[model samples]
Target chain A: MTDKTSAKVWENVPSPFCGIASDDLRIEVCGSSVRVLANGDAVTVPGFERPVTDTAPRIAGEPASLEDAVRRAAEILKEARLPVFSGFGTDVNDTRAALALIDKVRGIFDQARAAGGVRNLLALADSGWIATTLAEVKNRVEVLLVFGSDVEAAFPRFFERFVWNRETLFGQDPARREVICVGRAPSGDAAVSPDGRRPQVVECDPRHLPELAAALSALARGASLQAETVGGIPVVVLRGIVERLRRSSYSVVTWVAGQLDFAHADLTVQQVCQMVALLNKETRAAVLPLGGQDGDRTASQVCAWLTGYPTRVSFARGFPEYDPYLNDASRLLKDGEADALVWVSSLSPAPPPAAEVPTVVIGRSGMQFDEEPEVYIPVGVPGIDHAGHMYRCDNVVAMPLYALRDCGLTTAAAVLAAIEQSL
Target chain B: MTALSFTLKSPLRQRLDASPLVPDRLLGKSPKEIATLDLQYGNRRIAAADLFDIAGDDAESVRISGSPKLDFAGRGMTRGSLIIDGDAGAYVGMHMKGGRLCVSGSAGLYAACELKGGIVEICGNAGDLLGSALPGNKKGMSEGVVIVRGDAGDRVGDHMRRGSILIEGNAGMYLGARMTAGTIAVRGRIGACAGYAMKRGTLLVYGSPVSIGATFNDCGLHTLGFLPLLLKGYQGLNTCFSETRACRSRVRRLVGDLSVQGKGEILLVA
Candidate 1:
């Protein structure tokens, strides 16, 4: 005997949990609970069905009114000589409002989920990047190259949403697309293609990604090599991979920037870009640098348009000054350069970075804190509690976030805007 | 042509975006209309007259004197001449299709994003993403000429479909990265990952070069056929390229980026 209630089904709901930003999730809301129907993977369920809790604001571990909380937050910021505004796990509007608050306080701005994004931005800044979208990957990609990162680990539903689809508008057989995994290949069970085909595995050390990428680039360029093996791949095997890419109608080289642990990790990305560029000379090739979870891309996009800088910006001088290496929140806090922190994360359950200075946290409703801060304001979940915009991992398309239910909680933008006004 | 000028009277408290104050948009507008043009200062949207004192009325040639934290000074201008007498802000001459924009002082990031055609010259340093795409766009600076007299920040000529960028001073990393086709010549030392993922282009580095990425191969000493023509194209520009005309077509060419198209070249001044 089970209890079932009438549910309202919503289609094409975009999941902001991962970098893929799959928009095909079908959400079925019944009463206070929700269920993901179409393309509802393990990640999607938890990402959308997060338990709503803590509707009120708190100050010093005690429940407080919204106006009192705003006034207290403004007092902290106004008194702080060096304040770091970080943990940017909110939507586009929230980021804009946070920026406004940061400007008023003359603080530094960074992201909690910024390591991977910062590295990628450095790569992009170091050498320009070439990227493609999910639609392009689904329709045109005939060959896929995954370097140093397990595709499933980062974007769990990547294959299901963009690769193993039952219907492709281009009429290309999904089974025909070749997947090439380089460096730390996934096990047989984990590596099974969605279409039941076997993907080619190039077994190599993940640390040697730079060398492997170099060898692959040399092979793609048709440089005659005397060695039988390069970067642990046989010359013949490398040639075969190159030949397939040369003949592929469209090829895509993808990697998770955060997965790369090399001292000069961007070098590996550069090599991959070079390899893809070479392949494009013969046919058509593009790069898919995936990894922008927790609205990292959205934060960077909003920051760039508003201040002409992506992240790690200091407004202490009354103008946004960008310095990726210097303005890192953790770094500044640890070095005692920053005297306070304004941590904002409306999705992740992760806690704020511990610092000696006073911290004001505005985070997910369900987030649990190990050490209570000076003030904690629980904000609504973007794409669930409030409607907003978030940039996809590709950073090309920005999907609209939909509000599923009327959860009586304040939005991060509203709180931050209020704080600015209070200040 | 008669020149219209706006001299800043005071320092700005915030960034002032003057994208709407382009020459083409002001060509037919009266002096009063020009002063009333919209401008964005931080979150506040103010008018041109609020920031600067306007004098004369010539849209074909407009000059902005003093810095005042102005950005996008000559943005999206087509077929006109604009001059900045002092330091400028970011995105100067951005998306310029056809015009000549001269900045007497430094410029900030994305100075010439997605430029179709124009001549942009910066006498001082330029920030990152010069002649590159906007944040998410694929291609950058498809057609244009960008000359930075001083040092430049990273990712110059990144993902450029077609264009020419010349930096007289040292440049930051990723010079000519992901370039489909273009010409970028820097006389100063370049940071790491120069010509990375370059499909088809020519990156001439006269200074000490940095990591050329493993994808590139030393093609050895070879006489490039395009060098002379390329140098001759900038003959009258009074750049380092014009001074190297005596070298003829001879250059220490390292043809590579063999990883992609292998058509792109990283040439060193012999």
Candidate 2:
């Protein structure tokens, strides 16, 4: 090991990529590049290094001053009769500032992850369910029931950081932890525990999760099923799983609502919630619905705090009105309800929406546009350009985004605030 | 207690967050100090005196007159009273711990949200999620009273834990949704899904209900003796509830949310 005291290191750097928001990463800075020392993987490599690329502000495809670009963007928005603000892939303060602009422009607000966001809030409004924090799951969770989703595919570092963790403060052995994946095969042929043990996965159709949940809930309630197999899984297998759940100290059912394939998929989510509730009566159980992609939760939280609603809210009536179905970004763009668009994506260098309208794009420096927008402003990434806050997937807590370097770039919040002032 | 009043010179050009200008911050301060207080206008920060003309010095009672796009009127206030003579913006009396907040004109979304104690009264229409929890927060309005004399928007008292929300006019859908413990009484017609997903709460509707959620099970109509006692509690609160004593007639009580706990109940007065 290179002299421990001689190398420059940054400790406790929180990553904003995944929903886990693990803050135990230790990074070693070598010029413009960084080498993640502790708890670093393929996900963290790009998550930490990509934001350091050069970016600039432009007006009509030509490089321009930041002030000039903001003024032009404001003028465009002021002239629009209907505007849609989407692709909110940034931090909390950025969303708050963008909301101000949305209000001023009488625009409809949404995020790239609006599909899952709508389902999550609708499920919450339809029925309240119990949830726990990440710490609780990492330390005390004995059984994890993943439904309809390959959690490892979405959250690459989840098992390493939480499930198969080696240094659990609680005495629960990681080797003995039970991880059951239903409706999808575990990505890695086999899921190995910290102490080299493989867990069983049930093969079933993802669409049948709702039925499976109902059947399992009934089984947990001591009801007998007439059918020998339900949802293509043998009743005996389900019974064995239920026995394991009851024998465990604490169990958590997890799923990514975004990955559900059915339309109005919140119904399936309701069933999952029901299963957790039913299991709680017999043993300690809770649901962990994870989907914090592209700062969706952060945007919802900011919008809820200001307008008392989640996304799909329109300030066009001079008063905020929320309609999850009517004001959906996809519907608005398809039906021509929104005549203009402002896309903000500072965390990831994703392309802007392909709507046939005047679009103003605010993205990371290295982002490439298929066709140039009316105006483009490249802002600093949240964890690199400025310190900010983001909510974890569990929605129980928010983690801080640290600024490791000053790349002389303005944040999306600053750009939107400037635009708001101009308007 | 003297009265301190702020009269807007003109309508606001942008949304102004007046969360920092609570009674506690202005109580012991001089006129100059009060004038120099900070307020967030859209993204710009401005002094208090720049937006409105100030008058009086009462700390216990504060009245803001005129129609400025002001929000967060009494945010996090623990004591005293705040009065808005004209239309108030969103989040009025948000997370307020104590004291009284009264709005004479229409109040915006999230009015009296997540209130822990004290009272909030709006004479005009109120917007969505009144007495509801902030997004991601599980509990809202753990303890308090909210009275809206006019119509109310959707999801009123959503996810409320413990409190009482009284609406004299019609209310939209999902009233008292997912509430663990609370009392929601609507004197006018209520929209669909009243007491939806409610684990333990009492929802009293005095008018014709559109529909209740599928999870609720009707327990049949009955003349409850406690109706008079419940009405007596709101006697002097508002004139709208003055006739609550007449609700001693038979009411249909439904218990439900069978999908979850199924312990909550909704009582419809005939």
Candidate 3:
């Protein structure tokens, strides 16, 4: 631990926990303890302030050297017929190391957020989508349409940082933007414009979003529907929303994939994307699919660059085979196909899933598991104990992370590389 | 000539890709050569004789005792007959151009996906996206006849260009979605959102659907002259709809999915 007099402040430090990658945080570190002095929210504040409890590697809940733990993990992987690498909640370099290890062991790789990510991926694979980046939304969005999600609840600083900013790159007035919510109401007032204008909320059940999306698409495409009301909302109200979308210079349709919790929810995303595409024929419009928290976007971006597929990849065929359904990590574990599991989550205190097979965990410092894994190696958090790179929710840019403290812990990439060498 | 046979030794720990076992790929090869064929098992390739007990002489007809771990059982076969006696995994008869592929037990996801021309018969229930396109592809089952004797999962005939899918049991949600042209007939109940965003197709439902999308405008009941003709096409297929008594001329015709300006028709048998 460092002396209290050596407390140092870090300015403009980008976050690895929040999906937005908020970069203007001022953090002060002293003796392995961190405090967010400015620009902190519910997500980033807790992320930076979590106590570092575990500092030693263990073999079956008993203290062991890091080398012994890694060797044991490698031995388990070497003897297994099929292994799965899941819960990839680390930075880019660590994820790359994990993928390399999975290929060497002929294992399957999946992320913790793959269930939600796959929903968006299926819609993208079935029918392509027109999407935009955060920079575009911050600069030129005149109208924003949110579907089936409480934006402020999941993303605390989404509106304050992007929607109601003081200024933009262009000369457009940010206070004149229009916010519209459908299916689910916003839990807070963050969506209110700077001029104190409340957003128009179209109240309806989340299950009815599919029909509403379809109706909106039909109306935007100039088709007349015989139904007086669709999904319990008057067609006239939907028409008004469409007219506003048409009249705007630039409009963005956004949604959180995790909030769409119905069967075949990808169809709803597809319908919304189709509506956005149709709106583009007359004016400018695009889609913004949110929810890339827990390093999901980083894992997908890194894996896609290395192997041609995004996630749910298997190297069991001596080549990367992409199957979103067959390669699911949870399904593989439940079906008794995998003989061993290696879970990595260095960003948060998320534990490895309970499995009947032998399991190895390389996770955050304070993760508590219900059942002790075969091997456990506590690692340092990126941006807190070491420098790394992480991808934001938009997936177009990867921001560099700087260390804020001198925590005596190794990085996940180093441990995984050591395990691969032992194999 | 005896039909070729391969019996599984036991349950597999890893999935096996049996794409090379099709008849077109095995013609003129002796039993010794056929036994030496390499199959993908996990990260390595193993000879066919290591896992299966091969026998018989004829290559035109092939029979295999399937496990749930057997995938791509008859992929890209242009001709001949391939039969699976037990459960088959994903991608069964995928990209088949012409032939008869039959499974006596349940089949996994993406069965008959991207099939061009052939007859795929599954005696047990089928998983999701049956007779649909491969991921990122636009067209699915361009020309084929898929008959599922048991219940089928969701998104049946997705983005299909042309084909006929007959489901004897209930069908899950989003039946016949985004089909440009096809005929999907379900004998049992169907889940919500039938004929969603379909540009053109015919969904014949014998049992009441759970829910229909509001976009599908109800056209009332009608006695169509083409109903008998459509039922006659299933005569030699050995399905329950093949019987003459099963032909019902009167149906509640709902034409819509005006969401995509689709001209598809959902015929509910009355």
Candidate 4:
């Protein structure tokens, strides 16, 4: 008797699509599951789906389909001798979410393939000695040098997740690592180390890296010079750097933003490596090469574990073989060398190459290849769509991706397992 | 590049050092001496004969048996088969030109350098910049293919002027930075800035872009002329590229990095 009439009122609440939230325009995102209300009436509908009308804010249409545009993007990157992945669709709605993964992959592929490949992140990860978790970086790593990359732009949460987190490995109390930044412009903005470790910022024009390296090399060997500014660094600061680098037992030299690949990047790395090598003479000196974003380490690890090398592999002979120059996807596409391709996309942002390479999709974005892929499968987003783990740019801390979305999807691991079995 | 073969019987009595400058030092040495030759591993100079029980020598090409882990086995060997069943040590082929160094396993970083022309194949994996120029040098992977069947460490190709780096797996970041001309490809996804400030080169990404530098322009989309033909030979992803009745998407073409007036291009297959 208490709710005989109200029970049916709740029963007829209806699904979001059909039900009216009393506000109609709010439910106009098209594909999103928004609570809907129409003209003082409630309706119930579910399973929102539709064709992409216009990715206006993100991309444009030139009287051509989006697939062609993606292919063209592939061609452009390839001609530029850049690395590209195929996993793009007209789904701008989803791409916004994939920005992080896309940014990571784009940075890594370009950096690794471009001239800046090594100093970008390869050297440190390859050393297998410098990689450390953010917690370790904040709590234990006493000295940290911020090179080219802006952690704010590159990895937004770098400071909060690693340095300033109260419940981190450094405990609830804030204990930060000493920071030193070197760059051509505004190098010290993003992070300066929260702990008493004030960053010694070395600002230089992008071109004067050689002078900087030579000066550092000189100071490293105990040579005294009269120049007040070297590599845009004052002598006083240079001395501090020398002293700090020499004294630190464990330290990481961050190289980002086209350090080695850029014109003077090589000089920068040479200087850093020389310092690390010198420090090795005294104690354990490790340089942490920053891996560009994307699950690059994951891909490298899986591929290396399965094959022998990383990137540009040929399975045409029914056996995997590494061929850097020849098997490079861009070269293969440009020179018409590779007879076929096995495009790999872990829900990265950009689409596959435009060079008509065969492609596959292995991410949870529900994306399909422009060209019908030999195998089209969808995996869940690591942290949101599905739950799994990924390594940070350092390839140090294994961060578990907690599931946030209720997408019924598989993980990269599962897809890899299936692909492996099928192969 | 011409392929040669050599055979070594036993490790040499003294350390056979192949200076990185001379290609003929290791390339011209006889198999009998190469088999027995040895060098200091770290501080202790060991005999090559003791390290690798040599077998199946290909002398004309300087082919050796055992693993690739032998440090400097083919330091600067040109025109040879420096096959290692296992991993190789650092400075494997410092400046090889017109030859092949095939490793069944991984190789230490800085495998090939200042390479004029040659092929360094790793059946397993490789460390940093397998065919790239060393530090304090202008060129990286000048002209050759450094193929790592497995994963390479880092700095696979630091400053490639004209060459290619093909990875079966993913690559470390900053792959083709400042590349004057070359290509760095990964069958899988790549790290960031795969092609940063590239003067003129191609970076083909089968995966997607996790990050796009503020360089590179976005050209209009088109059905690229070369994509389909090349897609035929690939099978890594067991994927195929072509327009079927089910396919209905268009490709985009972007030109210019505008940063350096760079002609570098980046593609994204829709």
- Largest lDDT belongs to which candidate? 3
What's candidate 1's DockQ score?
A: 0.10
Which one wins on TM-score?
3
- Model 4 lDDT tens row, A236-349: 777678788778766766655333345335434645565566666676656665543444544443344445544444433335544343334564455433323334443343
Residue-wise C-alpha lDDT for candidate 1, range A29-73, written one tens digit per residue: 775467788886656678778777788889999999989988999
> Which candidate model has the greater lDDT, 2 or 3?
3
Looking at chain B only, the TM-scores across the models are: 0.93, 0.95, 0.97, 0.71
Interface C-alpha RMSD per candidate, 1 decimal = 7.2, 9.0, 1.7, 20.1
Tens-digit lDDT string for candidate 3 (A243-285): 9999998999999887887877888889999999999999999
lDDT of 1 by residue, B145-262 (tens): 9999999998898789887998999998778877888899898899866776677888988885455555566777777676777778887777887876444745676666655555
lDDT of each: 0.79, 0.78, 0.89, 0.47
Give the TM-score of each candidate: 0.63, 0.61, 0.96, 0.45
Q: Write the per-residue lDDT of candidate 3 for residues B1-270, one digit (tens) a residue.
A: 898999998787788898999999999898889999999886668999999999888889999998888999899999999999998988998999889999999899999998899999999998888888877888988998999999999989988888899999999888988888889999999988888888899999999645688778889999888888888988899997877776865899988788888899899988
Superposed by TM-score, candidate 1 places the C-alpha of residue A140 at a distance from the truth, in angstroms, of 1.5
Q: Which ten residues in a row have the lowest lDDT in candidate 2 chain A?
A: A1-10
User: Model 3 chain A, poorest ten-residue lDDT window?
Assistant: A1-10
Give the chain A TM-score for each candidate: 0.93, 0.93, 0.97, 0.60
Off by over 4 Å in 3: A1-5
DockQ of each: 0.10, 0.03, 0.65, 0.02
- Residues B99-196, candidate 2: write the lDDT tens digits: 88888998887888899888899999998889987655678888888999899987788778987889999897767776888888888999765665
- Once superposed on the true structure, which residue ranges of model 2 sit more than 4 Å away at CA? A1-8, A29-38, A51-54, B1-270
Q: What's the true lDDT of residue A323 in model 4?
A: 39
